[model samples]
Target: MVYRQEIMLTGAGGQGLILASIILADAAVQDDKNVVQTQSYGPEARGGESMAGVILDIDPIYYPRITSPTVLLSMNQQSFNKYIKRAGENCLVIVDSTFVEDVGNQPAYSYPITARTRLELEKEIVANIVALSIVNTMADLVSRQALQESVLKYTPEGSSDLNLQALELGRQLTHSYD
Candidate 1:
């Protein structure tokens, strides 16, 4: 099991990468782990590049930024191109199959995250939560219950069920990664 792990989530500004990172960090914190989260975005709000980094450790965190991530979640082609090359050798590179088509020959997990949300749940905004569920399941970054609780805590009111459904669908999608 990994004691210290670095995770990076990248997408367009409106894709909710920041929220996903927060949820992941919150779950880690709930588990009594030390987690540090940092985010960056381009000048534009919606269409610009967005990135969030989280470092998790059992001991006190000395640094919050991630130079090389062990897990990279790329929600678009641009993010995939920007972060994949810098990922660690065994990095679990996850890409949104619906939006990222240029993953090259990398051994990565590809899923139609937003497509599943739109087609199944009828809402694409919860794609981040879905992606988070996938990450939590595949990487064992956090417990399912903790991740679910963090999702419900961070999710806006009146949409808990929708996000929960998305999270469940994402968990179901984890089989595809194997």
Candidate 2:
């Protein structure tokens, strides 16, 4: 049986974690992979923490909740520290190094994901899309065409080009590791 792949996204609210997860999940669907997504957040929308978990399988995806993710993207220290240990052994951990100084163990890759977006996209929220691009590339999780299509269709209206840059930036970050 073809193995399943799982990915998790975490960060404070307004970082675009939920938006990025939707694109990734949609891309998996386009590839005919079974997909499940779950998210959690605190009381308010702007300042609290948030997270998204996505599970993809070649066969049926029974549960929507992730038991153990194979890939993790964390933009804050709190979410990173909490879930870092729960991820699988071979999992790839991607973090925004500018804000997170303490990511414990398990093979991590750090990038100024949020900071770069603030400069390039002129907005802090677009960082999640940029980070998602890197996650997709590093994991070989989704095709660029699939990503492009989803970004175009799903991004908040009038924010297309900015989102595109986020995806490209994410793609660029993966090269540093290779």
Candidate 3:
């Protein structure tokens, strides 16, 4: 089977979701997959809406835009409300339960992403990495080693251990859901 995915990651601008998308795209490339990534954010740059879209396929991807995402990850309530409507009916929805209280009857995998990052990893900034790890584990999107390499490559110096712990915590959280 040809591997293909249209992934949308949404949240506020300061949430680091764009970086997460880049990491995911790089991991896909590391796995020898063709991938394209794009992003947009509001003027406020921090609290304003932000979204990143990534398309991955074994075959060539002619278009980079995501009209109907196969996977949707929303980090906040506003993003969840805005982008969830654009998702396909069969889209796999993942929400950060710490920020999104209402999933509106959608079959969403709710995780305490920011809360876990703060409580477990002691740094909420790595919540994006945790969320990426959760999405990767749940979707089986890429090799764990590739993802780890990408994470280490993209993250800042001296924070590798925390990010790695965040990744493991995310995987453990997904398993706990099952």
Candidate 4:
């Protein structure tokens, strides 16, 4: 049997959603799964909205876009509002609680990811890494080892440790939600 899953990572520009999507797709490749990754960002580049989509399957994928996601990681209210309604009932919606206030009645795992990245890690730039960790842990979309390797691969040479720490923080955050 063939299985397919779509994942969407959304936030403002400069949040590293595109890099995270690429890393995820690379991990899928390492795991011998077929994956297609795509991204879009607003013109403003910094505060504007950003979205990354990944479609994974055990077989060849005919379509490259994700109309609805099996999982969603929303980092800001705008991205959350834009994509959350399109999510199916079974979607695993993970939101950055600090920036996204209204999650409505939808079953979601909310975490203070940005706050933790800033306060705990003292590196606000690693928030996206934290989100990736949470998504990887909760969705089990790829092997932890593979995801870790991919993280190290995509992260800047001197900053892997911080990103790795953020990843661990993200994993730990999932325990509270579970």
Better of 1 and 3 by lDDT: 3
Per-residue lDDT value at 178 in model 1: 59
**How much lDDT does each candidate structure score?**
0.91, 0.84, 0.94, 0.92
Better of 2 and 4 by TM-score: 4
Cα TM-score per model: 0.96, 0.93, 0.97, 0.96
Clashing pairs in 2: 130-166
Candidate 4 per-residue lDDT over residues 1-178, each given as its tens digit? 6488999999899988899999999999999999999988868868898999999999898889898799999999999999998899889999999899999988889999999889999989989889999999999999999999999999889998898898899999999855
In candidate 4, position 100 carries an lDDT of 96
lDDT of 3: 0.94
lDDT of 4 at 53: 97
Candidate scoring better on lDDT of 3 and 4? 3
Question: Residue 48 in model 1: shift from native, Å?
Answer: 0.5
- How does residue 48 of candidate 1 score in lDDT? 90
lDDT of 3 by residue, 1-178 (tens): 9567999999999999999999999999999999999998877857999999999998999978998899999999999999988988889999999999999888999999999889987889999999999999999889999999999999999999999999999999998776
Give the per-residue Cα lDDT of candidate 4 at 38: 93
Give the Å error, residue 102, model 2.
1.5
Between the candidate structures 2 and 3, which one is better when assessed by TM-score?
A: 3
Runs in model 1 deviating more than 4 A are none
Candidate 1 lDDT by residue in tens digits, 40-138: 997887899999999999888897889789999999999899888898788988999999998898998999998988999988989999999998888
Arranged by lDDT with the best first, the candidates are 3, 4, 1, 2
